[model samples]
Target: MGTFITCAVTGGADTVSRHPRIPVTPKEIADAAISAAKAGAAIVHLHARDPKTGQQSRDPELFTEIVSLIRDSDTDVIINVSCGMAGDLILTDTPETQPAGAGTDLLGPRGRLQHLDRLCRDPRLKPEICTLDCGSMNFGDGDLVYLAPATYLRPMAQHIRSLGIKPELEVFELGHLAFVQKMSAEGLLDGAPLIQFCLGIPGGAPAEPFILDAFKQLAPTGSVWSAFAIGRDELRFVSLAAGQGGNVRVGLEDNLYLEKGVFADNDTLVERAVGLIRGMGGSVMNAADTRQKLGLDRAH
Candidate 1:
């Protein structure tokens, strides 16, 4: 019930391409995790990057290295893997194209979850929490759409729950929240459901205070929730989320610049978020408190 902060260490496939300071290798991510923990982030939502090219990857080895590095550091931040990988989007050549392009890697629900299963199998790399994008929508600058129908989500939900890892339901819009509630009603999402209200993506929910408030109203009663805004509104939504009794998330995955033309690393983002949370008279939760608040069992 108290405020908790999560730092999304490195995100977006284009992050390294966009910012030189963004963490890329295992050591960099581990260092960033420690810095974030020191700056009051209780959780580090992880996404691995290709060491050479800095592109996003689901390689189990990469995940293992990152997790192990963090574990060895004694930082104690909760590790949350992204099950929302790159395999869901359908990017067609034109609006009328029946088939998607080579750039797209659309797959069935099970295929999308392959990396998640791999991570869950390793005791050392097992994520205490993982993401479950509740609904799908368009993701590109034009006509690319990501498919996440209930047909896909239901089976994925069962798999995540079976792994003994909590699913952080990522709701991009109010309708997505309604769908997540329906899943809870159907008993797919067991225990105290954790939800993340994602706002201000290109084709999803807009980042406005009223829009966030409406999504907050739609949250299942007694459920734990967090909220984040992408790009320019990241800090604004952190304040909004904390004031509204929800947790906050901030990092390079959602935004690149700390200020105009000024690139930010994970540590700077976490430091800024800590300042904002404390500035509003809200205290940031530690890893143990965060796990307790979200009903997550500590990983051995």
Candidate 2:
């Protein structure tokens, strides 16, 4: 099958101020996703934010509204909401006083999946795929961490599978990939598991070609995989991923620039990726073809 693109429209990053137009409101995010689909993205990976404050939120209603907006539209882009929220753990100098500091938004598995649960009540609003962060890691500099231990992840994966949603295994490093393999061995994942190699984060694996080659080699056989790198390396990895016979992802979530000193929106990033893929002599798969390739259920 040909390569497909997944556009991560807006994330929990502090990019709203960095760029002129970051999709913060539910309508804006939905519009960005739809526009990206029109620009040749097969899937639109999404996250919800507070409309007024432009801050990150895990509120199920916000997600429901966003999904509703997208589904109501004519676009048939595959929806993939993040289950990676509410997992941040910030440390304090006085460990006893503040184990999880002010920035921390840590929650157990159920709280993390609440948004997906809310959307699942209506088949039409249910996302075709949701993310499952394979393991925990130090997110960036400072004491902040992205906490997703195996104990929490196992149950989260089970719940995601039970909901009839494909879990995109997001791995930041080799250890995370190992945990994913362990889950697959325990019969937690269904069908050919979808994996996403997330590289070039401050505390994660470097976004180097050799690193991607290693990840591709270690990944489970027959698993459908895609990859992305944050910031400047985002576009570079698009070509690298496509050239290596895998899928590609691009959007303002992971990058804010179409080029140096040039701010970008979701649609432009997807369009640039489409150009890169076609430039590499690769066929860009549409949403229907990607659904078939990934075995996504579209009964809704």
Candidate 3:
């Protein structure tokens, strides 16, 4: 009945230049995940980056190397690979080029699953869970769009289920949760849906108490849900979520500072989350207990 923490070690955001240390390489990312696990994170969410340029990458090879390192290190943590990459749709003003311009990496549902397909084929590389972004949204206040329509999500969910990987339904806004309910009603999702309320992103839900309360009420009943906000509100949501009978997530991916002007790594962010949950009189769940609770397959 205690809350569990999911540390999103590194996200696909362009945050390398902003933070002194953001885990750009496979080794660094794997090391961050392992360290966070040691610091009491039950799950480590991951996103790969281009080693040479430090740009976000959906390359299966990078993921292969990253997961191999984690599994080889004998770390006991749930691996949740992000399937939310390659969905950027940057709008172009040029009439000739039309919709997509530079930085557009849109792909079909199956195309987006290329990395998962490669990883799941190898028993040793298959992660315990993978994310399924439930809807499309403006990436920010810019021309970029994170496109993942219902058509794309249905097949993606079905495919993730087929791979025997638990799907973490990431809802960025209230409307997205409605789609989750629909997907659940249609049986696209397996087991009690694992939901993550992603707040504080521009053009998405704001990281506020009233909004979080609304999300909690609107989320599907019986869902194993966690909530997080970006930047300053990241750790604050940890306290909010646990106080409301929900799990929490925190890491450098969401926030880069332990406090004002202080850089934070994955482990410290997780350690802070542990303190918050424990101080609230809530126990923390380990990787094994998390798997059982989420109905995930045994770790390979």
Candidate 4:
């Protein structure tokens, strides 16, 4: 199992306030992605933000501009736009009120896939792959939930399949993996399923070696798996995952620091991950190799 490294350039959430180097505009994102690709990342997991306020945006225009910029560049990195953006819900309560203050939230699967349809419909901007968060969880911060019931996931899987885009099943916990396997058994996910193990998020799987090993054992048979850890456990899990015959993911989207109190940029993260993989006698797969390995058809 050769290692394939993916750099999550910018997530469509509130990381800008935490990291000064998080790219906000399409130009910045495109540049960061290209830099990561040049360093070692084969796939660039992308999420767009509002240029002015740095708020997450699922608007097709923003996604289109970002994808186009990268496609026009010399970088040949495979693009993976996040379909994980639209399902977030944030609710705030008023101090004096019983219910709460004004917050944010979105309901239903159709609402979540609205942005996905826009991206998939644009022939010039179609991503070769998009994420399918298998199960709902309490996304860190505030009283919010990232909802993805089986009813929602089944249809979303069908929709992504119809679009000819590979769905990267993101499993944050053991049960999430089970759900993905069930979906695969149901003929929703095509080919050998691609699974991403997300570790060390609040309310999700903790960043423990044993936990990762358990999850690895639970991964769908014949599925391709990649692993990532957030915050302090980033590099530790990178080495562990690569050593354990799984690919690796590392970026500011998961961890803002390269070292204690040391802020790192996206390219630096990619470079470090590549170094670790190579140091461990693992070869990093290129975009073409990754596409072939993951059974993905190139986007024209």
Candidate 5:
């Protein structure tokens, strides 16, 4: 089977602290995405951030600027915006002491989709796909928990369905995949659902061969599935997922180094993925075919 590779640019959080060139501004983000598309990525996934402070943001204006720049560049790539921001639940020192600490960014379904809604107003700026974190789980070993309980997901899923845009279900655990499959059965999701297996996270499934095999068994039938792992497992999963009849994702969002201590940019990562896919005897897909396969709306 052919592969659909997506380059996840700068992540959903502050990455400037992690690496020198993490793409904080709109122009930088757009430029990185353009380069990724040229390097053979079918889609470019984006997460907004404050231009000045290099902090993560869900600002519609920021998204507008990024989308506009990408569109104006005449780049032929699918734009996959992120809607993963949640009302953070942070319990400082003790649960009773600081129930909602300084790091907490608690928000409801509507609040999380605010930026997505604003983007839809302009057909040219609308994204073809946006992420939907499948379930609530403790974010890493920290005091924060990324909450996406039934209450939030029910309405949020409905909103995404109404928009008629695809929601790439971000599955951190097997249970998350099971829940989204149920939602699809109930007709809350549109088209052939796209499920992204996100492994190697702190509180979720580790990047192991057996776990990936199990996730494939649990994934919904007739769904477009892609998988990615953080850090070193990132490149390895490319061949593994393709061998298992799934697509793959790669970029700076998951790893900074192209090699041992060698920091790489978004374009470099995309080029590597292209080489890997071709090396595996699988052809890399372009944006137009990817849109047709995933049932995504086109940019005007």
Candidate 6:
């Protein structure tokens, strides 16, 4: 298979104020996805932000607008909506108090998947895949922990399977892959399993060649996987991942810089990845081919 490029156009949460062109509205997000498809991206991962405030949103209507606009356009990229929302945690400073302060957005399985439920029911907007973060960890500094407890994940995995949408397993740490392997062995994941090695997310594995190698080595054999890193390591990981027989994911969602201190849009990042893949004597896969490769057309 050729190197597949998945462009994550916008993230549910981001440092959007730092960059001027982060897409906030449905029209802006759809336009970015269309441009990425034109630039050789096989898949477009989507996240919705409030139109007025630009904060992350779990509103089904926002997703509907973005998916509708993209489908209405000329592009034919596979839509991968983020099902990993409302996991943010911001804790108070007091050592003994242990109170989750202003930024906490944790939700139970059903609450977290409210938008995904709507997507699965909407024939026109149902995504080809949705993210399922395999484990939980300390997000950044003291008291900020991200949770995807097994108690929550097992049921959520079954729900995703029932929806007939592929769950792109997002493994941050090596232990996280254990759950994924378990799910696959138990027949929860249909077709070939799809995995995404999310590197350099504060608490996860660092963005380095050896760490990525370890992830690829430990994943379920024959799983179709893509790997990416955040910020400065983003492009470097692309080159490293290509050599390891993994697909590539790049876009403003992962990194804002096109060059040193220069902001970029989704298309530019994907175009650069296409060039990088071709430079390595590999070609970029188109949307239809990627879907076939990932067995996206298979019934659940």
Cα lDDT listed for each candidate: 0.84, 0.93, 0.93, 0.86, 0.89, 0.88
TM-scores of the candidates are: 0.95, 0.99, 0.98, 0.94, 0.97, 0.96
Output the number of the lDDT-best candidate.
2
User: Which is superior by lDDT, 4 or 6?
Assistant: 6
Query: Any runs in candidate 5 off by more than 4 Å, and if so which?
Result: none
Best-matching candidate per TM-score: 2
- Candidate 4 worst ten-residue window by lDDT: 94-103
Ranking by lDDT: 2, 3, 5, 6, 4, 1
Pairing residues by index, what is the TM-score of model 5? Answer: 0.97
Task: Write model 3 residue lDDT over 41-99, tens digit each, in one string.
Answer: 99999999999999889999999999999999999999999999878888988847597
Per-residue accuracy of model 2 over 126-240 as CA lDDT, tens digit each:
8999999998899788898899998999999999999999999999999999988899899999999899999999889999999999999888888999999999999999999
* Model 6 C-alpha lDDT per residue in residues 1-300, reported as the tens digit of each score: 798999999886566788899999989999999999999999999999999999889999899899889887857889998988878777788647777887898999878888888876768778889999998888765667888998988888899888888999999999998888998898888888999999998878889888888888888988999999999889988898987789999998889998897888899999899989999999889988998898887221
Ranking by TM-score: 2, 3, 5, 6, 1, 4
Model 4 has how many clashing residue pairs? 6
Worst 10 residues of 6 by lDDT: 291-300
Which scores higher on lDDT, 4 or 5?
A: 5
Question: Which residue pairs in candidate 3 collide?
Answer: none
Q: Candidate 2: which stretches are off by over 4 Å?
A: none
In model 4, which runs have C-alpha deviations exceeding 4 angstroms? Answer: 91-101
Q: Compared with the true structure, what per-residue lDDT tens digits does model 1 show for residues 21-80?
A: 888887888788788888888999888888888888777778888888888787778998
Candidate 2 local Cα displacement, residue 129, angstroms: 0.3
User: Please, what are the lDDT tens digits per residue for candidate 5 over residues 39-147?
Assistant: 9999999998898888889888999999999999999999999989866788778667657778788899989999889999998888888899999898789887888
| CA shift of 196, model 4, Å | 0.6
